[model samples]
Target chain A: MTVQLDFLKNVLYFSGLDLAEIESIDKLVFEKSAERGEMVLLEGESATDLYFVASGAVKVFKTSAEGKEQILSIVRPGESFNDVSIFDGGPNPASARAMGPVLLYGIKKNDIEAILRNHPRVVLNVINVLASRVRHLVSLVEDLSFKHVIGRVAKILFEQVGGGQMGRGPRLTQQEMAAMAGTAREVVGRSLKALEEEGAIKVDRNRIVITDKEALKRVMEVSS
Target chain B: MAEMPGIDREKCDGCGLCVIVCHCGALTMVDKSINIIETVECDWCTDCEAVCATGAISCPFEISIE
Candidate 1:
């Protein structure tokens, strides 16, 4: 198989597999593509395969009865998704939609199960992955419960841009931040302005650069 | 569609989308679940229900004004 070795070596899910083992997976995997705004997996539908983003982004979200899209997360390249439902053999709790033209490697659920059975180490790695996700979700819940909107926005910015000072901050628009935070765009704008006034961050066009990581971290730590 | 009166404790992921969408603060997350703090003054416009992808909120069978 002519699969990209770098992608295989770098992807967390496939990192453990050597060339031969990866080749076996390659045989079972096939490439798929989707246009922007297209649904990859619909909510309440059973997942048939596990997908890894080879390129582009996908948004995992659920729509309310009133039709508002609640974005769970925006998945980027090298991330694996659909595993939650695939492993449980239950219908997808949420849906995934392509954020743009997306390239993915899809492996049948049965093939992955077989791989895990034979490659016991892979199962352990999967457990670690799931545990890490659970930890992240728990943290998200805690943040939503106690942290104010500004803190949540700052924390999100920190996660996306890291601790380094950037000449130009994140390129995300306020609307995007609002969607991610499950809040309104105006609220995100107000929070960003407040952060800028404190010299904690600076807005450059669409981006917001963090002036001080330690201060922002402090803000995230402050309750209520 | 009639507005969902409130979330059943058994459901609701507490994702905060309902609170986010409600122009009114009728919906709030409590103990990782949604609670309708007030049902009156609820526009009954189904705005919160529109955003609940998990189907956690069910519409009130009958609307009663307080």
Candidate 2:
């Protein structure tokens, strides 16, 4: 199958590559699709290629002793999965499942290494991505320790409200918000009630409408 | 859907095992005791509870702020 070099060029890692280099890199990359509920990777399996989401979403999670799966991260389009394990020479640390119909680009580590050697810009881009991940992890650690559960839940809703079009929506279900916050579903339910009573936000089904962004930010400002 | 295991500051002996066993890097050694960091990645797996020997960990069924 022909690789979509032009499309690949738009991804940050490939933006600096020339057409010929893009074609060469694309030759080593393959496209794959997964339906919702399909496992993308098995935990403890050898890590081989990194999967970049081109469309749809995936959930990274691991099974607990009680056989309950704990979601570790959500991978959206323009992001890649299995990065940390690949860098550590370790097996896949977690399993991934397609949150919905997903399309991904699979690139082997060797190919990525070769590209990095030739085009150092790609390495910088990857480093930026990994650094951002580390920062996010660090922030989460801080939130768990210092912030009150209510503040954490409110902050979660506020953060999910991005700029324009996407921000104004119905309130999300307590379960989904709790899933994203890594807390109990009821914790979210209670927090939403508190916020609603305080006129912080309005909850409607699974959508959370940010009625007062400033007030919500104040609610999240409490230290643990 | 459980409260994340809580760390008893007085009981924890500053051992970092919880930090070591946590797959999502949710547990951190803060001031010599184990503390859970709220990352979107945390799944409340209770690994810290399983690893803690002092019985300092507990996952409450609820966290009501009101």
Candidate 3:
């Protein structure tokens, strides 16, 4: 019980709450575990609860009629999702899938609403986070629309490296890269090949190594 | 044909930013106006809509999937 309260207090949305408030929230939340590739929430489903990642990761994405997927964002531990649906009283805007074995704390909408009503400051925090999300979505739109495949791939690489720097990032598959870039897998493959030819990035069996970050940035800057 | 995004010509300043942002090459600029050249490739991600500073482009027929 104390452990759960501690976890609740660490969540950004609940961080403003005092220990007593955190304890109260802990009572209203329940833990849910999902294996990798499990669908935690489906797009268009009624938003009944808000979820906070307790452990592992979740991928929020949209799929087309032809099964093409565009990843919106990846929610890491301590992050929350479905807040928009909960507040707007609308269905989920996107689907959430477990990227790995995941643990989440599900807070019923009614319970959360009650807490928010009592603590208006928490609402401010929520707004701040939502605003950042808007910025990210706008940047993603810019990347997809204005940037070429190689540029998009380079941008993703730089982002994964925590900005344009030579570093090892997560081991992402070609399909994952395609989804992040909002393009097809073949396009991502071709772009990576081009980058490799330019001596900008080194591709291994599972991961990519940034050989020259400046070159990658130059690739992104060259207008198509 | 896939549902394509609508551009409000009246509001559009013909900045051509939307043309540059479309990854699928669905948008083109003809006579300083944005046009949807290929609707099939358009995933309707609304990248053009998001970047439209004048709020000119919108996806009227596009469902709110995300």
Residues A1-224, model 3: lDDT tens digits: 57778887888887678887777778899999987778999999997989998876677888778676677776767889887899889999999988656789999989988988988878888888889888878876665566587888888887777774434455454556777888754456567777888888875423467778788889988834
The CAPRI-style docking tier of model 2 reads incorrect
The local distance difference test score of each candidate is: 0.68, 0.68, 0.74
Which portions of model 1 miss their true places by more than 4 Å?
A148-224, B1-66
In candidate 1 chain A, where is summed lDDT lowest over 10 consecutive residues?
A: A162-171
**Colliding pairs, model 3:** A145-B21, A145-B22, A146-B21
CAPRI class assigned to model 1: incorrect
Candidate 1, residue B17: the lDDT equals 60
Complex DockQ per candidate: 0.01, 0.02, 0.01
DockQ of 3: 0.01
Computed on C-alpha atoms, the DockQ of candidate 2 is 0.02
lDDT of 2 by residue, A1-224 (tens): 34366667877777677888788888888898997678999999997888887776677878767675545666766678998877788999889987656788989888778888988888888888889888866765454455466787876665555522353433343445666777654345456667887787775422356677677777888622
Error of 3 at A52 (Å): 0.4
- Total clashes, candidate 3? 3
**How big is the positional error of residue A48 in model 1, measured in Å on the Cα after superposition?**
0.9
- Fraction of native Cα contacts reproduced by each candidate: 0.00, 0.00, 0.00
